[model samples]
Target chain A: MAKNLVIPIGPQHPSLKEPACFTITLEGEKVVNAVVGTGYNHRGLEKACEARTFIQDLYIIERVCGICSHIHSTTFCQAVEELAGVEITRRAAYIRTIMAELERLHSHLLWLGIAGHEVGFDTLLMYSWRDRELVLDVLAALGGNRVNYGINTIGGVRRDVTPELIEQIRKVADIVEERNKYYIQLALSETTLAARLGGIGKLSHDDAIKFGAVGPVSRAAEVPDDIRVTDPYAAYDEVPVTAITDNHADVFGRTVVRVLEIMESVKMIRFCLDNLPEGDIVTKVPRKIPEGEVLIRTEAPRGEDAHYVRSNGTDKPDRVRVRAASEANWHGMKHMLEGDYLADVPIIIAAIDPCYSCTDRAIILDNHDTGEQSVTDWRSLREYSINWYKVRGIDTSKIKIAYSPLIF
Target chain B: MSELIAEKQALATILEKFPFLEGKLEIQRRQRIISSALERPLFEEVFGFVTTDGGFDNFHLVIGVDDGDNLGFIYVLSNDDKVMLSLKQSAPKSNPAIKSVCSVFPNALWHERELVDLFGAIVEELPEGPTYPLPDGWPAGNYPLRKEWKVEYFDKVNMTYNPPVTAGKEEE
Candidate 1:
């Protein structure tokens, strides 16, 4: 009971693809506390944007989140275009929607692989990643690049989806759908995977609401908050969105939501391709943006990706703000990690699909005995409230008694 | 059936309810423009309208504009009905500060920070500090988004990493 052990989970951990550390405090195989350390991959993209022209900023924004690249560019473009008072053609909007959906499909598949690996299902990881490559191939075929598809411009999309590529996308969609179904069955059937995920890292509806959680995480907890349906952008208004939700509020539920969402995205892509409207991809964007501001939100694979853009009567925008979904769900990680087995920490953290590139650096860990502190797992801060509160003279029942009576 | 007509009606309704909002709030078919003094209050009203109607569930984007002498912040709010509201608020260049809509939208934190960073416009009552793409050691007074500031040269270097020192097998 007196002894304590500190284990550093990363800067290079198998669970994390990015560089970050999670310091977990162990009390005999059970993690009593966890702390997270970031700042390893801070590129300072926002600061760099100021130095670039409005057109050049598109490429920079696309790199902000590799998986959600299209959303980033679209959000940035929408903001700037609004400032410049440019209206994109209907065909361009459809193309943008299609590209965004493609990104979502690939991103979710990539996440599925990582989620699989997190729970000790390496085969699922391999298969999911292999299938994900096809989506990348499709992206390269359409946008001429896999990662930073400079398809988006201020007025509209820079590239057009040829009829032949649309046919190929349809063919690929069929193949991916068949494979996705198999994986979903495997994920649901495998007892080991189920045991690791089901009822573990539970985020209740109330907790999800309080944290302002979005994307698949909030949907899994039964919150019907999809930006596509709520804020219809691109061709989303014309197309129907059958938003997926699971009330389980667990890792398995999140997986179910994401998998189901992939199916919906495939259907959406097919619809967009079949009804591909004919028109110009882009319009003339004025060099100088009239003085104005605009707030726009688009549905990224993770959740709601919102942007705030301001421009003066100049070529460069006065200000640009990106509120990514990862930043919103970062706080929810604290609630999920507490009172769980030490082994489950990595899987739980992975559930939120955090993007450390968009968040703050430095995670602090304090030792009560020595009054000394060190950088530790960011999740431990959430557990601290419960851990220290239990030791204090404050009684939970008494506190509940005091608050419940007033409510009644 | 026209979006412009619907937006005008919606604007009329908003102005009728909040009588003090007259003249302070300007509506253009899908766009709503407002003075900077009423930006925060107007944001609440617009958000309330969307939530009630269940149409404007999506937040489009927030943009910041700097008029050499003053700063202007514009918010574009749209509903599922296709009606758009473009809201504008102007703050003086000397002390540019306006209330933040993060409390209402939850997504305004990033937008406000970008405004603070690029335009040097302060978002009053914002919980978070400035978070734009500025690098360390950049001069404080210099705001990059202004027309006066020009980029002299672009650095090609990607990122600088500080490797952590390990004390043998004991650390592992």
Candidate 2:
């Protein structure tokens, strides 16, 4: 019998872009046990949301995930709107749907690139990211920012989908659709992709449900629990959207699902643009929502984005709970990581598209790790980084920086 | 069938399957969201029934709320392509305990770990995990989400080490 080796893979590592630590216990090359640790980026966004007014929280909530900003704000606004008993016009719904799908397009493309990078397929990474810019350009044209597009408001959208914007989105959608078709063909036909990813990170259909996996991770396991189709919001009920599923139950399954879904998003964008409705974009909803609780579930590109808003008939909410798609997927991560080679860990984590900043909503600063000098100010952190990098033969001491107070 | 009838049928179907849920559940039309209130003791039983016999297997999320005297919890569960149900329960603020359904719904453990941190929720058999979403070595006895809790509670940590003369207070 051999003793298991414990290996830690980061709160900060080369493989993971975000901050999360996965402690993997391995027997030679095979992972015998895996424990996923996250908490390095906790920002207490929910607590912040509670203290601010609905209007103020809109900006905070939208900034939850830089990738799927609109979906988070949409869920928050829909919950508030439901509590306020306000009905948005069809034009508003359609525009919101367009934004949501456009977001999904960009998000899935981003994931595709990340997944490719994880698997050492640099060409695919280059291709997907290059095409992703087109989607980002359309989003920027509509909302004035490439990311964190604040197009959503309480009762309706802040900006209307103009004729020029519609034409621009349509052109972008066509290009993305054509490119994703090639990716879809590559995902299905590429023997090397199948061989490398086919049996890797295999999560069975039953285990996917048992572990409460969401998004393409669950969809890859052949579970069609898509919030977009199951509980439609915005213009999803009107737009022709179908849940994409694959039976591979591995990283390849996730890749296939995301590529196919990009095509579906393109189809949705074209449909919404062709039948663009005309009317008022914003509605007159109250500043103070009534005393009630409403739960909103919307499909983010990753998976189900659920928001729970409880109002006390006041301008600010009583409680705002956000269950990002990645949180649910994290529950099933241990199941995915174990029994695979340690080398396959990064892609498995990437397959779920873990967003640490969104999930870490409790709190950050360790107020009680006493007696040990931790990062107190920008200058100390800079000094520590320079020393640490100098030890690794990288001289960062040449870069001069200014001292600043802790922006707590 | 009309949306109202479909919603009614959905509610009736659940009520018929679990007699304990009959008086506690109501559906909101157009939204197709059903909210059910259950006592804390029955929380575990309801979780079992729904996942096994009651046909609601997909557990989405568990939200813990602090309501002054009592802490409220809402469990979001659904069937595949079916109606969404928010099952609610509350415990007194003094205890704020919840039965861990991780044995049935493996995902509840993560949400429960979060409840332990932000709301000071005590879950029986929570199966040891990290103090999620909260940095390691976070001060105990401070639950930030409760109405009574303020950032001032951590003033001891915040007050340490004065900043440089050039800081946020400094005029550019």
Candidate 3:
């Protein structure tokens, strides 16, 4: 007899941090089907961006993602700048480029650390996180904040970089660069890691393209789909970018691509600092942007971060849509999650380095309807889950979740 | 830039095939982006051509817009050289429907699902599944992304006005 056990992995699962629920059907320990649901933390940012003034929307847009804050804002600013016909100074372009690379460095380091933690390599987590602060320090000095660096403005960047600042950034980048090389060797060669992650979350090159996966995920699958390399934004054209790709096409490949890409970020930062152009950081532009629509993309550390701005010749935009890199990557997740062992679920989900949006949850029925086709809030879902376990003779009633203190 | 993707050729082929889109097509060379506004009926044909023969098959994303009288969708696709083409199509606000390109671009699944939830843009052939970017059992007719759907309107509906979901169901 083939026993099929339907398992809901999130919405409030302790192991998963993101507010996404994956309903996985397992036969013994093997996953047969997976349906990915996200959107528990929906902030209605796109709609909100439309109602507010362009200046006000910049703040809202930056909040779209915690890790890739600058990338979001920079892409938004670039679209607005393009629409306003404001050609930013060479120095501003280089500074934005430098900041972008610095962001990539910190973000990749954060992912490496998280991957380490997920895989039980806590030493890598501690070391990588400690080194991450070095990149954040450069960001703090430049943008005056570690997260949501409000460095980008409509016409150009708000901050100006001095030659001295460039040298300091170069020093930090080089140090981080050396550390990443070591990580690259470790992630690629570590035997235990290879055995654990090599074939767990396999997404082939054909599937990667068919599903339109991006950033390191696609690169790991050998798709070589990177916005930074394909279309030069910021200082990418001035400073060369090598889109690091791997053929592993699994969690291991993603790991290698990300670590090697961090090295690429270091090289980009060095080039920008050494060839630091001199000029005013910003250009004056009109407040009322002429009616036009523009779509702009930046290679966010996670994937292709795209922003579309449609103006109606007004102080406020007619529409502003932010397709965060994570949104694009989510489409491929079900494909990855299916056919993997139940034990490998956590590392597999973390392998994407997901920075999830709080939007909503869903229940997908594929032919075999379980009469659970209903939109559920956290409270009911939690109750149902607890009751579900209790019915099955496993009491999780004593599990005290600190975040949801009201779950009595 | 290759022979198939050289700026003029990529933009012109669509216009040549669909002559009605002659004035609607544009190519911004510096940014390496192009735009062509096609009718609702012509979306599948043009998109199928672009993805297959046109060599710009990378399905990036779809942006759903709420125009005053019509609903707009911009299907963004790119090629290896990084040339992006925005295939713009719109359906009348009263009808408010568009075709799904999922058969061509499998990744259009979620993006199309999002359009269905937020804008209430009826995506024909959008696989019957759970509502996306929106929770289940959300009021069927209320499309939150439309311009007429104001922030204040949220207060009247349980979608916004209801007490936080994190609170235990026992309280209610």
Candidate 4:
């Protein structure tokens, strides 16, 4: 019988954007079980919302995620708008959709590059990242910043998408479409990726549903759980989503689902641009929101991100609890990682496009136990792994290190 | 029937089957939001019926609110486009414990843990583990999400601070 060995990866691992420790118990190289420990990056955003007024929270929530900032702000605005009984203009709705889809495009591309780099394919990483800058440029052009655009307001969008901006978006979309097609082909046919990812992190169809996985991760398992289609919000009602799904139920399935969704996002952006309505973008809302509670769900690139807000007839919210898609999706990683080899950990984790920073935004707090906390940065983690092999009487000098940029 | 009427009918079916849920379940006439605040003991039975007989499969979220005297929990469940249900329940602050709903919805385990670590709400039958979403060895009894908890910055280093007036309550 193989002896049980425990490996603790991260509160600061390279693949993880925020601090989360996963204790993987292994029987030889196969993972027998795994446990997740988080809260290193919880910044108390939800509690902070209680101290800030409705308007100021738009900025605070936007900072919850650099990648999906707009969705967080939009979801907050949606819930508050519902509470205040303020109806935003039709033009504003379409503009919100455009910004959201554009954000989705950039995030998926970002994930693709990160996933590529995780599996020792730096070429795909480089290509995807360079192409991703185009989407970022479009976002910068529209919202006046590359990330955390701060474009969403209490009732509607803060900025308007001009005709010239639409033209620029279309041009960028055309280029992105071409690049995405190549990525789709490469992701499907790439020999190294196929060997590393195909049937690597399998989660059955029932497990996806049973675990209540959302967004592309669930969709890849043929669950068809896209919030944009199921519960249409913003201009999704006007443009709509086809909800791409795959039966593969593995790392490859997640890759295909996200890649196809990128194309879908591009199409949706173009459609929103073409069919955008004419009206004032912003609706005037009162400083104080009425007493009420509301739930708002937005289809973020990673999955279904939701915010539940309660107001006490005051300027500030009584409570704001956020449920990021990653939180819901985090549970399923254990199921997928079980029985998988130790080497596949990074790619398998990247397959979920896990955004620990976004998931742990509201949870980050002070670490008072400085005496006991042994901070293991990425470089040290690599060193420790290599040394662990050496200590086990295995020579590690022959292993060649591949150069991949630390994008996170 | 129109979409609006069909949605109403689907929600009506849930209320109709569970006759005991009459006064507790109220529909938001404007948005067709089916929501109710029930006693703590009633959550499992009500939620069970909502999933089994109510045709609701989508577990939207579980929100734990620190409502001063009591810790309020809102279990948001939905059935596609039919109805968005928020099952509200609360346990007294003196004894902040509620039954675990992981058996009803597996994803509730995450929310249950969040409630335990953040709001200090004791979820009965919750599996013992590390302080989730919170670091291990985090100062005991410091529930950051509680109402009175505040972050005080001294010398640009933030620390969890609660006013002396609200300190020393055993959340367990």
C-alpha RMSD of each candidate structure in angstroms: 16.3, 10.2, 11.9, 8.6
What digit string (tens of lDDT, one per residue) describes model 3 on residues A1-408? Answer: 978999998899977877888999999999899988888877788888888999899999988988888899989988998899888888899999989989899999998988888888899997898688777767878897777889999888998987667767877887787778789889878899788888989899999888888889999988876778777788777788888999989999999999888888888888888788888998998889999889898899999989989999999999998888788887888899889999999999998889943222334444456555545554465578789999999887676522222111
Candidate number of the best DockQ: 2
User: Candidate 3, which segments miss by more than 4 Å at Cα?
Assistant: A356-408, B1-5, B31-36, B160-172
Model 3: CAPRI class = medium
Interface RMSD values for all candidates: 6.0, 1.4, 1.3, 2.1
TM-score per prediction, in order, is 0.71, 0.86, 0.86, 0.87
lDDT of 2 at B165: 44
Which whole-number lDDT from 0 to 100 does residue A378 have in model 4? 37
Candidate 4 residue-wise lDDT, B1-172, digit = tens: 2346646666678778767777766666433464566776577677777788777776767898888888888887777563667778878877888888787677778788888888888889887777666656566667778775665521123434444443535322
Q: Give the residue spans of candidate 2 off by over 4 A.
A: A356-408, B4-6, B13-23, B30-37, B156-172
Residue-level lDDT of model 4, residues A1-408, one tens digit each, is 767999999977776666778899998899889987766778778888889998998899988887888999889999999999998999999999999999999899999998989888888888888788778778878887778887889889889977788888888888889889999998789887878889978888888877878888889999887778766788887896899999999999999999998899889988988899999999999998899888888899889898988899999999998888888888788898999999998888888887743322122234687644445543355567779999999867665423222221
Report per-candidate DockQ.
Answer: 0.10, 0.55, 0.54, 0.49
**Global Cα lDDT for candidate 4:** 0.81
Tens digit of per-residue lDDT, candidate 2, span B1-172: 2556655665676677777676678776553555555667687666676666666776788888876788888888776437676888888988887888788788888788888888888888989867787765666666778876655435545433233445413311
Give me candidate 1's TM-score against the actual structure. Answer: 0.71
Best-to-worst order by DockQ is 2, 3, 4, 1
